[model samples]
Target chain A: MPLQNIKVIAFDADDTLWVNETFFRKAEEDFCALLEGYMPKEEANKLLFDMEIGNLPLYGYGIKPFTLSLIEAAIVVSKGTMPIELVQKLIDIGKKMLEAPVELIDGIEITLKELSKKYRLVMATKGDLLDQERKLIKSGLEKYFHHIEIVSDKTEKHYKKLVKHLDIQENEFLMVGNSLKSDILPVLNIGAHAFHIPFHTTWAHEMIYEEINHPNFKSFTKASDLLQIL
Target chain B: MPLQNIKVIAFDADDTLWVNETFFRKAEEDFCALLEGYMPKEEANKLLFDMEIGNLPLYGYGIKPFTLSLIEAAIVVSKGTMPIELVQKLIDIGKKMLEAPVELIDGIEITLKELSKKYRLVMATKGDLLDQERKLIKSGLEKYFHHIEIVSDKTEKHYKKLVKHLDIQENEFLMVGNSLKSDILPVLNIGAHAFHIPFHTTWAHEMIYEEINHPNFKSFTKASDLLQIL
Candidate 1:
């Protein structure tokens, strides 16, 4: 309830302060059009999602595998009807995803500007080399983080690694984000505090359990709405 | 262009037929507030991003790990200030995502109904088990799809698997939807016809390359606006 003894605060990227997944969705419709007559619209999406799920272990989080996956899907769907020129364009579409600009959520800048005054912020996320860095730079929020880790996994080991690298005790750190899995759970497991914030577009992969009875778990309903509370 | 030899049509899920990402976004803002005095807002987001990136491998796609990621970020940001009472509520958000009824995109059902008359329809998407199924069932789109496959990856192997399973050829299929990686590129890669219909709320991973110069690769700028082309 009362803000007391707060030391280091961690934030989640993607859907937290800015919009991320929604942009990826824009490409989905474009992708579906690539295979109109061969398979059903939903079948094609299933195929791509399967590739993403399959490649997650090998590729982690990035656009390259997704591109390759699309390429692979195109090949399967082509089945002899797709033209070379058209296939080339489809491949290009996959590559273009790498360069998408970051768009922050509304009211985010003002809320962050206000919250920055009271907390020592850090960015803890999982993504590829260029994608995450590009987002940070594009979002104009990179300067705020004292530490940035683009990890392949977010297991307990990962959290412990960050704690060790930052030299911040669990008790002295707090986590925040739209994801309970990466944003809240591990940090809480380590005896740190956590805040759960539900987002609108909960990705199928990023969604996780919420915390209610932990020694240090909290939640809010809005961005700037919480500024006065803090 | 004129419809030629088009028979069965496939649709990609996520952004093609409905709006999905808006939910997670609203949740993230709530997650960020737990880090009042510990960290700045930007720092908190970066940390949350780190955590999400970490969870990509472990959870892959679904609401489970995503929710967990948020909870973890909350803990890390709190640094001990996040009250435990909010933890359960945070986890509940994940369940809420599943429980939330499917809200179709503007004119999705109408478009699908119209398109079904001229082509065979089915759904092809890659996502978490319960999440996609729940969405499909609640959206009432399940009846339209003659074949539905919720696979782990969308690769050549999987497409071929679907093709063999569904007894369809690439030339006889057309994939439509809002994802480039899942719907466009992969279907194109397989020598099949593909369509690119762009959606506004695409996911980051699903967005891919775009090409306006393909023979078999067709696209519609708007979802329900497809009728205008004919």
Candidate 2:
């Protein structure tokens, strides 16, 4: 079950191609510190996670929604007495996150460059379109992708749509990414091959508690290993 | 010419199908009020507009980017001494815009319901994916559209890509929307038929000072008028 017949290799942009979840982790730490007076760091972190999950339907995914959730959590944790100063600080935190430099994962460029020569490469990621497009432009990897899809969510249906738009069969598609929740499971469920390249920091929302074993699934420790796997 | 042989009829979401720019206008006024201590409303509006144009490439479009621009403008206008309250107020303004009710333009439902019977209706809008999707879902008119495209920009290249993806000839496509800059000119430039139904309030960025007249173009005062023309 090697990548023998796959004609399209789609890469997930965030943690798989570049460092993403680490910045979020750092932002969460900073958010908790900013609200330490209201609640302990652990409690504050849990409340923020709850707020993010609760607001997912309303805000979808991205730094903006995360920032909004941070504001809402601060107000709730502080019993609506949260000063405007802390709220502004939270907004600044979000701005800094958006402005952060895109640090590509080790060996991503060589991997993509090499893969592009053989298979059609596509970027499939879900986030704020502006932020994601900015990150892609900054990464300087846009030229390698044949197509880029900034979708609302990565469900089985979305993967099917991507394959249909690419005019490729499920067996001809392969997805690679860092998150089992977003990148691997849904793709595998759609009967497409998926490879998981673990990043050190995974967002709480993207964590999967149970191990998934599937015939179309493979795990690699580093992106460079993908060159040999394919 | 009638809409005979038209294979696709696409509508712009923001001002074409529903009320959108008015909310942005309201947000701007609220933002200026929040920063009234630092600058007059007119001056602040100019500066914010300048910042938005400057940050367009980096932030693209949507309430989130607009919110970021508001924050950046406040910091610059206040010379880094802006109070936290103002920043918080800006964030709230953005949230309210996102939360604003989706009020469809008069006769939009009848037009869509009628046009959808004879033509392939699509939603071609430029905005944040989440915000646009939320608005479509809230509009309760999602079922009328055969396809929905939330794109980064509306340009000749974008329209070409859309027509190609939809598997239709440019001459067989018709675009209907409010903005001449975004909806009309680009579509007409790409050799597609376009109809303009003017909205009462147009954003500065969307305003076209020069008149555009093309053989493939027609003007309507209201959405209902499209029923008779097509």
Candidate 3:
């Protein structure tokens, strides 16, 4: 197998490990509904998305940033006349998302359990470190991974640093995740192997409208399909 | 010296290496001033502190959490009748804090540069990973350390994990920081060496009233004082 030389396997945590975007989607719907009087639901949702993108560099990502954006967008949508209770509701939505239970992706546990036997596994994710660590513990999957690598953003430079930290060559590192933007392209660009397993919903910010055809890249329909090869 | 066995030195980032609490102090002042119309500044500041502590378990520590708490506290202080402009101002305050310049504490650079020659230096900090990394880059202190270890909290369990991750024994790890609660107690409790360097200002939430009398611990008046012993 082309992946036979892989010594360290890193998995992206959010959608790849469990249900994340679904909660965000739900929260967005709730926000749009709350402000439907001021603006159309679709338009309000788009505005909130734009606000999030604009704040990405300053706030990074997580429920807290999203909650802040929701509050700001509400103010803009309502022209600073919306009830202050709406702000509280947005904060509650963000808190609820943080407290949401972990829902493991199908066959992910078995996939991790099987793969952990042959290679060193790590959860390489970009978000709030606290939230990711809490999720890993709640998922009861913490034991399967060597450690979690929490980054502000995943880029080629980060991948190179990860490889160096793990004391392995680029060719010996394999990254498996659902996002082509954060996980796959960076790893592949660094001459490491990357596997893509698409999730049901992709955050618009993480969407890349392009076909990837690389020697070090592989795409699978589901998590368990990896067992067929390495 | 008792620290002769220490092979790795992890420094706390916030008030230890640079000015962090001062920013929070300034933000709290601005927050209280904004709501002075609804409540007295002292009472408003106290209420905001209470709100932050209450949200700690759910929100963890960072500027984003603090910003959310400011907004929530504002809502509570005004009983949900505050102007939307105030909310926007709170958001702006948080953004400015994130973009604030990194002011290196006096003698911190020389201390780190000197320590790096004998021990593996790391920034073992409890904060948002991205924010900490950014500060390290801005402080121009990233070059002196081996790597950065960012955690949500600094409990005994977390310190133990850090020591294990460093591939060293308990005695071989030394922690130096400002807070007795987070940086000192936890590290010493885990059978590692810890040094205390008092900062000019301390966050009320991180305050400890008791005197520590650990054999493996040493206290210093400033950052450069560390160079005298090591």
Candidate closest to the true structure, highest lDDT: 3
Number of the top-ranking candidate, with TM-score as the measure = 3
lDDT of 3 by residue, A1-230 (tens): 66889999999999999989999999999999999999999999999999999999888989999999999999999999899899999999999999999999999999999999999999999978889989999999999999998888899999999899899999999999999999999899999999999999999999998999999998999999988886
Better of 1 and 2 by DockQ: 2
Q: After superposition, how far is residue A124 of candidate 2 from its true place, in Å?
A: 1.1
Taking all chains together, the TM-score of candidate 3 against the true structure is 0.99
Would you list the rank order by DockQ, best first?
A: 3, 2, 1
CAPRI band for model 2 = acceptable
If the candidates were sorted by their TM-score against the true structure, best first, what order would they fall in? 3, 2, 1
**Tens digits of per-residue lDDT for model 2, A153-208:** 99998899888878889989999999998899989999999999999988877899
- TM-score, structure 2 vs. true: 0.85
lDDT of 1 by residue, B1-230 (tens): 43466567777777776666776665665666645466787787778778877756434555555665665676667753454444545655665665666778778787887877777787776655335655777788877766445544576665666555456677777778777777777777787777888777665555665655666787778777766642
User: For all candidates listed, what's the TM-score of chain B alone?
Assistant: 0.84, 0.97, 0.98
Candidate 1 Cα deviation (angstroms), residue B174: 57
lDDT of 1 by residue, A134-162 (tens): 67778888767654554456667667766
- Model 3: CAPRI class: high
TM-scores, all models, native as reference: 0.47, 0.85, 0.99
